[model samples]
Target chain A: MSSTTTTRPNGLALFILPSALMFALFFFLPIGLMALMSVLTGNPVVMPKVAFTTRHYARMVGDPYYLEVIWTTIRIGLVTTLVALAIGYPLAHWMARIKSRAGHALLLMAVLAPMLTGIVVRTFAWMTLLSDKGVVNQTLMSLGLISQPLKLMYTETGIVVGLVHIYVPFMVLTLTGVIGRIDERLEQAAENLGASPLRAFLEVTLPLSLPGILAGSLLVFALAISAYVTPILLGGFQIMTLPILIYQQISANFNVGFAAALGIVLLVISLMLVIAYNRALGLVSGQRELQ
Target chain B: MSASIEIAGVSKVYDGGVRAVDAVAMDIRQGEFFSLLGPSGCGKTTTLRMIAGFETPSSGAIRVDGADITHVPAHKRDMGMVFQNYALFPHRTVAENVAFGLRMRGLDKATITAKVKAALAMVELSGLEDRRPAQLSGGQQQRVALARAIVIAPRVLLCDEPLGALDKKLRQQMQFELKQLQKKLGLTLVFVTHDQEEALAMSDRIAVMNGGRVEQVGTPTEIYNQPTTRFVADFIGDTNIFRGERTTTSTVASALDVGKGLILALPPTEGQGTGVLSVALRPEKIRLITRTDAATAAGSSAHGIVENTNFLGGAVLYRVTLESAHRVLVQQPNAGTSRLFVPGDGVTLEWTPADLVVLKD
Candidate 1:
């Protein structure tokens, strides 16, 4: 405990100590080190002397290739978030309304089954289903819908599909918790007030679940942007997101400073998204209660 | 604009063969405030829900204004219901909640606004329009629920213990206000409550239910004084029940021999010499006097000692044990000047023979 623990009086500082320390070690310290590295003169290899420079940040700003990489990363993140939300929202509503405990548990288990597998394994599973000679192409060819297999791998679409498969369970779980917190009788009251079933759902349930949609979408977007393994394995050499570019700069080109610069850019993007999420959540929750 | 509802032989059988409402029937006249009163799991709520179209009866016909609505969906029934939790839309402001029913009916915006204004005024919730349900207190939320339901001018208003969440004082106040609103609107209201006192105080007529069956349905006075079933008598208030065979002590003295040495004289009322064995006697009807009169007082009386005393502020209830080991409950009003007895005091419990209600077995 520090001075803050005694000052808190309720011991909340002590209660949050573990998570704060974990965040520092896993996030804050690493980001701090990377920020220092981005300005240092030398690569990780042995150097004669160390000097401070802004070459990496300048290169990232002026280079067209780097800007394209940033845009591609944003596009993939947006598409993946949209797809996951489209598939997760209705699934969450249905699961939240399940009256029986066993049925709700079974459906939740089905949603979480993909998450139970490791990310690499889950990516490979999607690879098997999406490859040209795999089940998807084979079924489409046998059904005569196409003369040849579509290019499903080593592309941005494949990377998005893979990232969506990885993060949809997260989106659904967040949405389900929020939707479950909403009272079911609100919809009943709507129907009793003479709204039809669809109207009641649209007016009552949809608006109440807006907070969940916002949180889930932002979560998926953040996860999608930060994704490394899925994009590298699925997009391969055909795509260059910020993470893939950063990996190439660090490993193949031995540019540690440039890798740190890219890491900072990615961190900045995530921070902006988090700020937007908080503001939007505040607007919604503030409307629900008095100051 | 009220509609009379008739439910005939209605039953709701859930899965696993549990009968929540079995052969329940009621004929609710137009503009009447009828209440279905019972303990938990006694089918009062189930009966109310079936009439609201939230539940489809397993085998029955339900008619509103002589038109069968048994198979209709909940939204199409055109009845307003105030849930126990006062489930106002949390995202909507109070004004929006009140305007919902009017908008659903496709009323013009001007008419919707006026009716919403009037509805809020009726519930005394005007000018809290911009606040959401989360911002209001429990009683305020209840009023908003009532405003939301009644704004539609529904043919019937259904309330599922809407006042159950409020504190005791607030609940009583809402009870009076709700009854006033019902009378003013002439709503064919069907209210459900587990509290016997609340049901008795507010309802024009009440259906006393037990074990998924309506034991009796009548006005409050009739149900309290002349309970046809032993369950109704016991459930409505505190009373002592005697079960035995009916016997005559003389040509003019009819009595019920309730086993042991305790024989209770029966009043020669409407149901005399009709073999009605079991009887119910309310605690407050019996008089408690000192036993020092040397057994001079006659009438139907018993000698007993006070076993316990419960002080209810306005009344003192004494549990007296008779010589036959039969306990008799007697209640005396706490008039500050009256003689107060402790637990060890010897007393005589006396009542006229007519005070005993001959229950149907």
Candidate 2:
């Protein structure tokens, strides 16, 4: 027994060594390089001596254009999260409550179908639906709802629409697992105590599904803020989110240090938001229990 | 407040032609404790749900306080239900769960608070108001469920196996407590359970169901003492059933040919010109006496040999093999003075003719 117990840890270490090495090589190395780059003063065109400097961080904080881009990214992230939640909650609830297996399978397919297509392809599909002289504008003009085409393809609203469509499936998938675990008998108990069907749903089903709502919101917000491809394709040059600004600093200007600084800032902000979101959820659920 | 319920020819046929309840009918008086007792899939819970308006009967109507409520929705039926699993909301505090029904009725905050307090106090869970349901013990959660249901002051309370989740001691204690509470509040209650002892202990009248049909409905005494069917007789308690054919007819007695030259005398029953008959006798009603003392007994006696003896806590059960090779069971109370028999002991089993009940199948 002693021999086997001593060898067991060795066996575990051997199994974990491969993934540990891969994580260190692919993940930690890049993060360490980015951190070093963020503080170094150098020109990307030539390999020069590195010197310590805070100018890049200061420039990112002091620039009003970068601040505006950060604020716009955050605003778009928040809007996309709220919109996904608003649409995902009812869809997930419907799917969770469906009695027929075929109905549940069909709804599940609909929720996951967009995910099967590449994000770029889906964004282009949205472009056709929202652009001037596109199907939406042509249909609206034919229906006499509007005489002129709306400016929807190159705006923040267009970016939000595309982002919500891409990320709403994440919300639905997370919430389905949570909502499906809620006992239907609790709703019946509520109704038996004089709550109507609608009241029971609002009182019992909604409150019990809060954990899912919190998790899905956090996931959507984090992904939306970091997203780049969909926003750039949909908003064109009219919108400048943080990711777009970072992309411009790297690819257009060859300012790798500034790009690394922007990436670190974005990471910090996402971390802070996630912490605040968790704290807020804990407070709300705690208060609910004490009520 | 309590209301009388009248179920007239109610039946529930599910999709694909499965009959969950078959034309069950019963009248429950105001402020009475009634039970629907049956095994699983016997439609007892289905009958209770129909009255609670969770299930609509496929045919016939239900009337509460002389008003037809067959088409009414469950929330509008003004009934309270306690589920088997105690369906308390885990997200809400005990006070909030108890206050849900009052809040739904649009009561003011102060009134809701006062009533919630009173209801919690009634179930002896007053101080645990702010605790979540998950934090409570099983009995405490059950009390919270009871308080939540009764806080609405519904017309009739429906409970589906309310005490089925508790341990044996807790179940017995809660059964007595629930009965007392129902009496104190003067509430009409419809309870459903499969345990015959639970049904006997709590219900004023019980409807025993089998195979989606009600086999019998009667008071506990009548159900135990004079069951009308073989199912009720066998289901309610232990009994010995003898299958035979009626051979001779007399005014005071009748003879049943039970094979092997053994003709048992039974009381005269209705429809005596029967082809086949089954007589049920309770084990407790049969007495075992020595073959020498059998001459002094004033009843029909049969010679047998004691095959086995089982010593229960309060009684002893003896299995006897009669001369005709038929096994008969007899239970005698451990009165501390009766002679105990063992295997290979020759004995005579005696029972009054009236104790033998003729049953249909």
Candidate 3:
């Protein structure tokens, strides 16, 4: 038994070697190279010189254009998170309340159907629906609600719409796991204690599912901020987010150093927000226990 | 103030054609501690839920204080329920849980605080108000559940196996405490449990159910001593049942001829002709006497040899086989002055005719 126990860790290390090598090669190496490239200065046509300079970082901070793109990205991320939560919560509650197996399966398929198609394909579908003379505009114009077609394309609203559609499923899946864990008897008990159905949900079910809401919000916000395809397709060049600006620096201007600096800034801001969220949750749960 | 409840001809049929509760009808008096005692899947919980307004019956109506509440929504029924698992809100503190119903009723701040304190004090949880349900022991959580239910002064309090989750010792203690609380507060309570002893100890009257139907409803002593059905006799406690044919009947006595030349005397019963009959006798009712002493007993007696002996704490249970090879159980007090019977001892089991209960199959 002692010999086998000593050999178990070595066997585990051997089993993990292949995945560890793959992660280091494909993930960490590129991030390390990017960090190195952010601190060096060189032209694409000349041999690169390794010199430590803070010029890229300075430009990213001092320039108003980069600051505006950063603000826009944060705004879009927050809005998308809010919208997805608003839509996902009721859908998830409906799914969890379904008693029949066939009904649950049908609702589950509907929630997951958007994920099967490519993001690019879904973005194109949104573009067609939001453009001028599209289905929404045609129906609204025929109903005489609007004299002219609304310009939904090439705007922040159009971008948020696309991002919410793409990421709402993640919110629903996370919330479903937590909501399904809540016992139905708790709600029944609340109602039996003079609480109406709606009041029972607001007082008991909502408070118990706060952890799920936090997780789903964090996931949706991170995905929304880092998304590139849907934002670029839906908003075109009118509304530029952080990821779009990073793409522009690398492809159009060939400024890899500046692009890497921007990427680092985005990562740091996301990390700070996550930390703040976790601290707030800790305080709330602590108060809950003491109460 | 508490109110009486009437469940009239109630039945529940699930969607796939399963009758979870048959036509069960019973009236619970005001301030009475009533229990629905049965085994699992015996529809006791379903009947309790229907009274709580959580389930609508398929046929009959439920009346509380002369008002039909059969179709009323659960929230408007003005009742309090304690679940089997003690479904206390984990997110809420004990004080908050106890104050929920009062708050929902639009009670003012001072009134709510006073009532919450009073309720918690009644359950002996005066200092643990701020602790969450997860922080308390199982028995403490049960107290919190009871406090939450009674604070609203509901018309009826429904508890579905509230003490089922505790350890055996704690369960016994809680059973006593619950009975005391119900008596002091004069609250009408409908309790559901499968434990026969708990029901017998706590309830003023018990409705013993089986297969979605009520087998009998009577006081504890009546149900134990004069059970009218075979199911009720076997379900409530241990008994020795003898199946035989009635050979003779008189105004004063009746004789049942069990197989193997053994005859048992029974009291005269109505509608029971000279045909097959079943007699149930409690183990404690039979006395094991020596063969020489059995000859003087005026009642009927059977000669048997002790097959096995089980020493309970205050009593001894003896399994004996008669000369005709029929097994019988006999229980006797283990007093120091009495002689103990061992295996292979020849004895006679004697019982008077009045002790034999004739039961319907």
- DockQ per candidate, 2 decimals: 0.60, 0.46, 0.53
Q: Compared with the true structure, what per-residue lDDT tens digits does model 1 show for residues B216-332?
A: 999999999989999998899889998877776653357887777677888767344646488889999998888766762333788899999999999999999987788878889
lDDT of 2 by residue, B1-361 (tens): 7999999999999877999999999999999999999889999998988998888999999999999999998999889999999999888889999999999899999999999999999999979988898888889999999999998999999999999999999999999999999999999999999999999999999999999999989999888888888998899978888888877734334577788856767774544564778888899998888876434333266888999999996999999998889898899999978768999999888888788887765
lDDT per residue, candidate 3, A1-291, as tens digits? 787667544656788889999999998998887887788785434755556789999997889988999999999999999999999999999998888889999999999999999999999999889999788898899999998999998999999999999999999999999899888889999999999999999999998888789989999999999999989999998999989999999999998899988888888888987998798678656555443
> Chain B of candidate 2 versus the native chain B: what TM-score?
0.95
**Predicted candidate 1: what Cα RMSD to the true structure?**
2.8
Error of 3 at B223 (Å): 1.1
Inter-residue clash pairs, candidate 1: none
Chain A (candidate 1) TM-score to true chain A: 0.91
Chain B TM-score for all candidates, comma-separated: 0.96, 0.95, 0.95
Best by TM-score: 1
lDDT by residue (tens digit), candidate 2, A1-291: 787667534656788888999999999999888888899887534865778889999997898988888899999999999999999999999999898788999999999999999999999999999999889999999999999999889999999999999999999999999899999999988888788999899999998888899999999999999999989999997899989988999999989999999998888888898898789789757754443
After superposition, the stretches of candidate 3 with alpha carbons farther than 4 Å from their true spots are: A1-23, A43-46, A287-291, B249-253, B258-261, B270-272, B291-299
TM-score each candidate: 0.94, 0.91, 0.93
Which of candidates 2 and 3 is the stronger one according to TM-score?
3
| DockQ for candidate 1 | 0.60
CA deviation > 4 Å runs, candidate 1:
A1-22, A289-291, B250-253, B270-276, B292-299, B334-336
